[model samples]
Target: MYKTQDIAVVILNWNGIELLKQFLPKVLEHSGDAHIYVADNASTDDSVNFVSKNFSTVKIIQNSQNGGYAEGYNDALQVVDEPLLCLLNSDIEVTENWLFAIIEAFNSEENTAIIQPKILDFKNKTTFEYAGAAGGFIDKYGYPYCRGRIFDTIEEDKGQYNDIIDIFWASGACFFIKNNVFNQLKGFDASYFAHMEEIDLCWRAFNANYKTKYVGFSTVYHVGGATLSNTSAKKTYLNFRNSLFTLVKNTDSKVFIRTVFRMILDGIAALRFLIQLKPKYFLAILKAHASFYKNLATIISARKEFPKRGNYAETDSIVWSYFIKKRTKF
Candidate 1:
């Protein structure tokens, strides 16, 4: 058994005591040499106390307040001295030797600064999870989807996408990055609060010439929507709004034109939501656009310090490919 002392498995928690109670044992058991820590996000619940009492060996970093995902990690990681950081979610379950494969890749792939392992669904172990299927890719329009997943469709794990490959983004659910690379990238955009921040960070990394990859051999089962339910209006709002924020901050000179087209596409999507009788979702899109337009100035200012990178998208318009051309499988 190879001992990897450089790795630190840190779980950012905000009142997820049950999830920690359920999954932390496997992480402690299976993780060979990496130290484990729970960065509590000012949870009012008994989560911090529980971990301190039961999991006495697991280190606890009690944050002053809940900063969601982006800022929570940014603050928690300030004291984590490990060279490699595994930002694991509380709702995920790891298999044996998972850390070994990731450590091995980090050792071999010098330029691969960020990596995400094969994330499968905990409910149905054979199927890919919605968060990140077989790595992430964006279309020309800035919409993100995975290899085994296109929009709402998730493919089964038939060992088809079992090869390590470069990705545009890694799922925040089980994200890994070199400590220096993370600090160099300035962590995630705290304004994002949560959803799509990982994509934004990965995009910035790509622009800086750092590669993100998917290691299919190391697998973990994720209970999707443990924090926020998938159908929640807040989730919808964050996805739509943060995606626009990402596009504006990361895209090149064509950002204005893309924003125009994207807004129109979003309108079409809202109409589809209405047709499906999901009024809340339709309203969510509208709210998202309103929020984006309101924060346009701030979002643009956020991009001033960062340089844009071209040739980032793998395909032009995943919406077109999925809807008009009916290309489901990636």
Candidate 2:
């Protein structure tokens, strides 16, 4: 197969030696002149040593400290000189066509800056994964929902969502993006740490006058959250806090005010967590708001550089209720 584009695939790993072994082989097998790079976020495990031995073709960078997800990805972005770059998670595995599919999407449009493939779960291939299943969409209120998911619900893949379409954002777990647009946006916002940085980046792309797409033609299986386990309270806090962080950063003044009002209403929902004795989750919500308020000046300054809403309702691109769609191979 002819290499259509030089792609830099950067996978962030932390103590995931087994997953590194499993996914790296498939990546190296089909990458086809694509430069593969792995950034270890200071793994205490033997992950770095293992890569150094077997994957001679791979470039491994062992960070001196465990910078959060955004920092690690920005670190990887520095060394990427290829026209196309993939921000991949360590837990994802792909077929030979994964790179090919994402590359073709970029060719479909001049303004396309980001693309995501059809993402399936590793255990059950038909089911959709958390981050990207088809592609991601968001409601008007800054709540992100994907074609495979709405709210907390994840729909069955069933070969649906195969149509080519524009999306608000794609999953960061395995994002295929353009290198120049990535650097132009200054990469992801470092303040986001782990969550919502991808969404924030896409919003910035819109501000900079580019488009993000979900390429249903290509596919990969995501094992989901291999770097950090889901049980961590830190993940919970960061996800909620960054949701609010992105809202303030991207939305117009009216939308931001509406979101703030809705968040106050949603505060009553946090009572369920407290009633269930999830004090940490309750505290997470509080800390999320506290963190946002504390950094108001900085957030405003950064957000002020972006353009406001462009005369379209944010909900126009999203469908919340039913998601079964006609499939196409193109």
Candidate 3:
């Protein structure tokens, strides 16, 4: 039953060993002969030791620092001889045919670099996961939305979306991409540290003109917030900062003027902290802008590498490009 195919599944683990205990066994049961690597981001808990003792077949990489999500996954994965590599989160439970579905979809494309599975929320079961429902899309101005989410509203899965389609980005929680393309993009930007790093990587894919697909036939349950809670100050900072990074790095010259205007509108989103009386949100805006200004050179470097940009939009009605209303922060 062991078809000698090279596939490596890289799971980024923090202090969430209990969650991994529930999910890792299921992943191994379905992984076939794929190499499994769990990279622990220096959890103070005995997470790495636990993996080392219990799962002897799976390799473990322990980091020296709590390098957050992006750094741990991208850096700890030493190298990949595998044709395909999946960067998975520890908080997700996958179905038996999950990896098979993604591999099949990738086989259908010659230049496909990334494949994202249909993601369902573990607690809700019927709702789409927060990262992205099926796949992500970039607006004319570089803001991202998904089939499952737009602004702050996450839709119910309803078994309604199962069609494979090209996407601007995939949710990072459970994503597969080719090894060469991953290396070419230099993987996730470590500066992002966590939130939206996948989108930034996909924006780089767009800049490189590689294809990304959402494999709807495969599904996984994500516990969501295993790393950072939406209401946490840290998540706000990373999300805001990475949003600016992805935008400045991917926008085309043709839309540069309109993109700058969109940045102003997006900046107004920080009003969530000001009008709603949340000091953390205000601090988020401050740090995000400061980081953007500080990394202006790197941002410009990425823009210079962008060969071309596509003209794509989902329209306001279909994409639900509405602003968020009075909603409790996750």
Top of the candidates by TM-score: 1
Cα lDDT of candidate 1 equals 0.92
Model 1: per-residue lDDT, tens digit, 145-232? 9989999989999999898989999999999999999999899999889999999999999988999999999999999898889999
Provide the lowest-lDDT 10-residue window in model 2. 321-330
lDDT score of model 2?
A: 0.78
TM-score of each: 0.98, 0.91, 0.91
Count backbone overlaps in model 3. 0
Which stretches of model 2 miss by more than 4 angstroms?
Answer: 1-5, 311-330
Clash totals, every prediction: 0, 0, 0
lDDT of 3 by residue, 65-118 (tens): 877878887777665567788888898888886777777777776878888999
What local lDDT score does residue 60 receive in model 3, on the 0 to 100 scale? 87
lDDT of 2 by residue, 9-58 (tens): 88888888999989999998877888898998888999999999999989
Ranked by TM-score, top first: 1, 3, 2
Regions more than 4 Å wrong, model 3: 1-4, 315-320, 324-330
